[model samples]
Target: MQQQMIDLEGPYRLLYCSSKGDKDGVIQEIEKGVSPNLADYDKRTALHLASCEGCTEVVDLLLEQGADVNSIDRWGRTPLSDARIFGHEEICKILEGRGGTDPVGLDSQSPCYEIDHTEVEMDGATLIGEGAYGEVYLVKWRGTEVAAKTIRSSIASNFRVKATFMKELALWQRLRHPNIVQFLGVLKHSERLIFLTEYLRNGSLYDILKKKGRFDPPTTVAYALDIARGMNYLHEHKPHAIIHRDLTPRNVLQDEAGHLKVTDFGLSKIAQEKGAYGYKMTGGTGSFRYMAPEVYRREAYGKSVDVFSFALIVHEMFQGGPSNKAEPPEEVADRRAYEDSRPSLSSFIYPEDFKT
Candidate 1:
């Protein structure tokens, strides 16, 4: 398949090979002295294709072959920019280590860029799980497992949403830690968003709790500690403090090693101050059951809101059911009153904490 692509016309072959994510073919073509910096009609080079495809091996090969990492397309986008905008953390790291280009800066010629990811072949890819957004399949890349999220066409729309999504992608690309789910890269097709990421085989904490009724104390404590550690990394990191407003069990995935990872930054925000947590009015978002009391009332809140949600998750882990189960009318009234009396940024203490 790669040879056929390489045998075709100039750089288009490289572009085609990169788009198809044929890493070996790309390396073969580059070794044959096909200019690693070759550009297509739009001035997008093979590096651009590899970066967009999250073909880290091909990208590394291209970089090693002296491909101009900073070469901007007609649209003024470099390989680094494309990798970051598509949430390809590994590719971004490679480009950053080699190119020294800024991923967050907007290209002058084109205010926006689009990724066209094809559906990777499903064979050999383990179907890990499915959700309202799409199906997540696990595949092996460079000897490591990666989660490939393929969203349907009906979910993606025009430039504005794409821009927002890319912004989030860039943010995730910059995140480097063990606890956060790593963004591998993106595969763009005419009508789909194929997001490749590090695969966590154990699935979500919610799944585990549901299937087992509840976790043993040690397991529950371990999960909570992992969650806290991840949240601390996000909230205390320099340059920008990320607030994961949605910290529900469903978003907390575990790996085979029993380590917890946080996923889905679609509702995350960057804090302006060291301890500040809330952002501008972006409307109510996140799962209702796990939402902070202040979030529901259109109030400004901060990192503590996540703490509150985390408290709720811990409560659920101990309760053996969903956190927002039916509450008596008096209890609901008391809860509402308590919420109204507290500051938006106040940390919520679980009732169980007092009982224990």
Candidate 2:
């Protein structure tokens, strides 16, 4: 009876072997009467582990031995889900071709869960940037380069954070503009929420400006025009007007061809009423350096807020510093000042004025 129970442990051992990519160990374990359907602590079966590891051989062997492909883990994640989340294109294709089940439909429950860190594989991907809420990686998808934004599991669990993520996805799906970063798709895993979009190799305009001191006249004008065009499209072309509450150089990415793309819509809002730009009282929505005077004051404003930020960016492009430069006290005071009494757009004095 003890031997019988040991033989029954075949499936669990097979799962371990498959996860480790040890084909010989898997065969040996199976010969000892181990079941191939045994699950781990997370209820993930051997097939799930195999798919996640991108071990095509292990997956094929298990499938040939009559392993159920439709089985889901505790979180209702099938092997197909693992393949997609790990970006295992070939394995995913094979599973799909073999009539694998759709993991997305297993549970109508919110697709938020904890993932084992060891299972995630970041292949052909490079981490390029990070922020308070998440990190951004560059990946190649189907021969095209893309930017994959991943929010950590802990952050995704917060209601506000999750809402912000969903809202960004909604905005991206409906937005159609050349100057905006093209929305590719989203990947939800037990460990992270990943967003894939066009990858801009040149990084943000802020980095370039900070490194190079300032942009030339034509370059500055061109960048400004691209931002304006993207904002105009977002505010006017959508079913509901969209307002990009956070517009900063860091959110503006540049491609190899020098085309600018607006990105990071996490703080964006949809405008419902005519002439209403959907300004929120939330104080921490935007970056300090690029934030408009009205944004800091928590006053009701409209699309003009964006225009104000744009003007500041133009100043930064030419002045080699942020709008608040050379006036620390005034900058602090301006934060509490009313929106109507804030300094005019001319506050961004051009650098050429003192070039003599």
lDDT of 2 at 125: 69
lDDT of 1 by residue, 1-356 (tens): 23322334554567667756788878777777788888753467888878875788888878888889898764356888777655689888989898548544753113223333433554667777774467888876545567877665555666676667667766775554446776656665544676777777788988888888865555566677778867887887556778888888888988766678888876787888887745743334666566676666567888887887787777777666663368543344246435552212212423454234
Stretches > 4 Å off in candidate 2: 1-124, 159-164, 277-279, 325-356
Model 2: clashing residue pairs? 10-34, 10-35, 11-34, 11-35, 11-36, 115-190
Listing every candidate in turn, what is its Cα RMSD in Å to the true structure after a full C-alpha superposition?
Answer: 14.7, 19.2
Scored by CA lDDT, what does every candidate get? 0.68, 0.68
Task: Count clashing residue pairs in model 2.
Answer: 6
Model 1 C-alpha lDDT versus the unseen true structure: 0.68
- What residue runs in model 1 are displaced by over 4 Å at the alpha carbon? 1-119, 122-128, 139-145, 152-155, 277-284, 324-356
